[model samples]
Target: MVELSKARGSYVDPAPARVTVETWARDWLRSQSQLKPTTLVGYESALSKHIIPRWGRRSLSDIGYAEIQHWISDLSKNLAPQTVRNIYAVFSLVFSFAVRDGRLVRNPAEGIQLPRRIKAKRGYLTHAQVHRLADECGDSRTLVLFLAYTGLRWGEAAARRQRQSIPALRSLFMLSV
Candidate 1:
């Protein structure tokens, strides 16, 4: 039995059995120095807004698959399916760290079924529709036209500097004229 447990990576130190979910989650968040600022914010939000509330006082070993799954179902009543998934992701990450750090023999939060994510149908504007919107923007007509023809996302385009984009805009203007 010892050999089988060792082979399955189920052998762990008992010291972490005393650590609560909130304590470990904070430690995990602090260790994530390489993550983007926005991603860190999302993790913190998921922890504070969802994961920590129910699991905070519970020790790592006290969290079970059934409880986690039931919590997800309850969260789906008021939150989007994607939001629930995000919350679960943070919770799961905390447990995974505990396993890797030898705090737990195995994660009890594994193998739970998550709600299916529903994708929205994408719509595209016609050329005339794009032109009408550009005309409506007046001063920002070129920006609208650039967005329509280029595949750049709003965030990517918003980060552009006028100095860096004038060359591209000049060519676009040449074609429009």
Candidate 2:
């Protein structure tokens, strides 16, 4: 009698207990057509690499806060803090959707303490430092100076264009995007 009230009101049908985490997650992903490309990729990566591997075979109703906390603790030992948070973001998103979809009464992924992301102290390049770096860069002097002044953050995988940047910077330098 108590279980009847907790069922998805529909996705449960005759057997709510049989509905695995993977099952609910797949449905949730299908309903999330509005996600951006990068967000979708991250969500999929979280599922395939972490969430699904740990919980895919388990039923939706079987999950709870303590187990998730332990799993997160395990993840924190290996991954960067930000990466763990990103994974938990995707995990929480799925369980939140399940609650909305009526598969659960509340999100199990909520209230768990995630790792903190500590931002690196931003270092400024002095005028002399910039000049020295530009001199060392030879023909790429213009590129070095332009990058030093701009606060735009770039990662290792970020694309850099050598020939187009000079002209592009000249035109776009005045406007802050």
What's the lDDT for all of these models? 0.86, 0.78
Worst 10 residues of 2 by lDDT: 8-17
Q: For model 1, how does the per-residue alpha-carbon lDDT over 39-60 read when each residue is reduced to its tens digit?
A: 9999999999778888899888
TM-score of 2: 0.73
All candidates: TM-score = 0.80, 0.73
Report the C-alpha displacement of residue 170, candidate 1, in angstroms: 6.5
Q: How far off is residue 12 in model 1, in Å?
A: 2.5
What is the clash count for each candidate, in the order shown?
Answer: 0, 1
Which candidate ranks first by lDDT, i.e. highest?
A: 1
User: Candidate 2: lDDT of 75?
Assistant: 96
